[model samples]
Target chain A: MKIDKESIKKIAHLARLEFDENSAEKMSKDMSKILDWVEQLNEVDTSNVEPLTTMSSEVNDMREDKVGTHMSHDEALKNAPKRDSDYFRVPKVLE
Target chain B: MEKFSSFDEIKKSLEKKETDCRAIVEYYLKNIQTKAHLNAFVDVYEQSALEKADQLDEKIAKGKAGKLAGMVVGIKDVLNYQGQEANASSKILKGYISQFTTTAVQRLIDEDAIIIGRLNCDEFGMGSSNENSAHGKVLNALDESRVPGGSSGGSAVAVQANLCTVSLGTDTGGSVRQPAAFTGIIGMKPTYSRVSRWGLIAYASSFDTIGIFSKTVKDNALVMEIMAGHDEMDSTSSRKPVHPYSELLHFDKKVKIAYIQETIDSSALQPEIKENTLSVLEKLKAEGHEVEEVHFPLLKYALPTYYILTTAEASSNLSRFDGVKYGYRTPNAHNLESMYKLTRSEGFSEEVKRRIMLGTFVLSASYYDAYFTKAQKVRRLIKDFSENLLADFDYIIMPTTPTTAFKFGEHSGDPVAMYLEDLFTVQASVSGVPAISLPNGKDKSGMPIGLQILANSFKEAELYAFSNYITQITS
Candidate 1:
């Protein structure tokens, strides 16, 4: 359960985050401590317990799908950092 | 003219034609301007609020006033207000505006409530103290040096300083109640799914709930009655029929109450707070309510279980904030992957990044069963234990927090210590049961100590009645 610097980097990459070497080392220590504390759950016997997904047992309300104006194309892209015409602009993916 | 102390008092004055909505808005706006040091408000809709108040006054003149006439409400940064910035107190969402309003806030507007502004909170509702906010830490109105217990600290302080008539906050794990406890106000987190989550900026999807912070328990009741109902947009919202919670404030029968023997006697509890809570229990018993001690051994697991599940969900929910559509984007990036990584690293604060990393590690392929799955099962155990206890006892009483509000830099060094602040308030949330923290007593230093009361799920009316009864007899 020990989280080394390598594991910390992997987790950061997985979460699309970045940290310098010093911060990554700090994260490793902090994550290790938190994991150790949360390990207390292993002491409980939950062999027959079900994993809870939702608090209430109510079924999702069913409604017929209908298309309506939610936000105009311009409104939807209003907050984009980089935009070209009507679409979001990202770095080229294919050569 | 007498100063209105509560929202109900304001309503009465408006009814008597003594004060119009415009004057009430002006009074609140002036107070907000004066109390700027508290950092309780993020955005104040001064012009819009006055305009809304003028419209409301017109309605009142026409004898068509709604239930929440002239009430000035403040919303946390997380709830969407359609065109207002819902940054969730995080820099990542700096320029993002909500495309639509949340069902809960819309309900308030429908009742003629005037939204004065957005309140500060922990970034994405993560931290216990308001220090995690990208905006800045909210100071406790009573003690400027002490931290306002948060992610709802600003909401609580707004009501505490009378900057607003009432405010709405979200509680995933003690966010509302802890701040309320610190500020000596009333905060209620109703049954999970009791309020719609469609427009709330997601922190932990399953556990996040819209709660109310008010000066009076009756105000919480009235707001909850208006805000609770199923919304087509939020699939998780409960289908339970909403009730007139304010009208059901008469607790005629003696109620059975149980105090967790472990919580009050725990060494972590401040001596003054423990004494105050025990005294309140004794008074409740003397007031003819059957009260006794109960043992809940699983109490220690509640904090760990809450953090594990919530952080995991937060990590997943926050993944949508990549540099694609909205939110902050990094200035320097060569590829799409680097863009996402750099954007997130630059945008998120330290506490947020730490949590996201922890969540990613826990839910990783190598440790999914050990951390994420195990935590889920433990959550089920805690839920069952709470339900069984509530089935026998009408209510469970406990101290809202182990201590009163902590001074700044007290527990900021350690994340675990900050997580421990949620120990008492997370069980009711995990169990999806309604819980309220009332200002029952005060500590030796004159800071407030909250008395937390718990009732079964969808039993908010009973919760309101019991709280009102206690308030009536005790204060």
Candidate 2:
């Protein structure tokens, strides 16, 4: 629960966010407070409890994979802020 | 009168041509305009709604209309209705027009339900109050200064204000129920996966459920029947046959009701809320129904455990909204990493960013076992408690919130306090049980209080039965 600025910075980076020093300081304090509260779960007797990964008791409700009419290329590109003729444009990923 | 009292009433009036669909749509449009100060809607498609009403009039003339014909249902902005922007009240999703309709919305359209407009909500369904919405806050219809509990605040308010006959809302952790309680309307979050999530923007996939808001339990039941079913596109949608909820509304009342005493007995409850909820319980007991107190000790940890699990899943689910795929993109980035950083920084609200950061931290390899995994274990303990408790009772009852609707900014500075508003409702979400909030009484300020009822998973019929009994008694 003792989060520091460095830990906050790492968490931001892992979440793909870039925070300034001020935000890091604030986040560190806020996160520490939250973690302190969440740590109360440790006192509960969960030794006999099984972990629940999925809520659905019935599984494998898969459908037959068939070709269906999906959104058109233009329609899919309509919402993109940066788009090319056939693809979404983004900052260069490779040199 | 008043454009018909309910959808069934509207359908009959439309069929008999006592009032045309155009008249009904115009009446609701006028109501929406007069109540614009409530900030209940993000967008109102007046022309589209009128056009749909005209089409339904033709269908009625040709004797081809279905149930809910010409009845307008306000949609929460998170749902994708083809050709309308599904912004989810977030600037991040601004101008994002859904190319395809959600199966649930489409089914309503096919049944001749009019899409009146899109209601406002918390950005990405992150906040319990409507104040977090990028479009601005939606005020409670009953009291302008108080919050219409959110993120489904607008949907609940719209129905309360008579802007629409009913509205669809998504409830993750009391999103629908809390707002319904605050606004003095009926809201039901059905069992997880009971309704399709295909068109819903994911909040927490495990707990996100499509719910309905209406003035009456019968109206909510009718809307649920129309919207509930299996959808192939949504992997988690139930393959079970959809039950006829309207028929089930008339089910025999030989059912047991268990008042969840341990959960309600917590010291956090306000005296007024406790007294009002207890009175409602007394009414249920006097109706010749079996009633008892059931204890679930693990219920205490549900709030923290829900936050941990939901935030962890949210961090992963929201990762797909990077600038490269869609949504807002920032200019002047030298590389993909910088672009990702700037886009997310500008697009997401402060609350969203905070949650994503916390989520990533909790789910990180170093802390996964201690936080995320442990929360999942606690989630199981909660679910097991529900399963065992439900074996003895047909439904469980409790106060929907510790206090009635609070004034705006009452808990704004303290996020933890705002989160505790969901303490009583999160248990049902975690357990995947169907639950509802029905307006039971009012506080000293005249703000409404809601009585919550929880039924075992896929037992919506029993939940509705209990709700109908309460509705009859209260009416």
Window of ten residues with lowest summed lDDT in model 1 chain B = B1-10
Structural similarity of chain A in candidate 1, as TM-score: 0.91
- Once fitted onto the true fold, the runs of candidate 1 whose alpha carbons sit more than 4 angstroms away are none
Residue lDDT tens for model 2, B70-129 = 778999999999998888887778778899998889989988999999999999898888
Model 2, C-alpha of A52: deviation from truth (Å)? 0.9
Q: Candidate 2: where is the Cα deviation over 4 Å?
A: B1-3
What's the distance in Å from true for residue B354, model 2?
Answer: 1.1
Query: What tens-digit string does per-residue lDDT give for candidate 1 at B27-112?
Result: 99889999998999999999999999999999989989889988899999999998888899998999898888989999999999
**Best of the candidates, lDDT:** 1
TM-score, model 1 to reference: 0.98
| Proportion of true contacts reproduced by candidate 1 | 0.79
Candidate 2, residue B451: CA error in Å?
0.4
> All candidates' TM-scores?
0.98, 0.98
Residue B7, candidate 2: C-alpha displacement in angstroms: 1.6
Fnat of every candidate, listed in order? 0.79, 0.74
lDDT of 1 by residue, A1-95 (tens): 68999988888889999889999988888889998999988999999998887776578578779987878998888889899878999975653
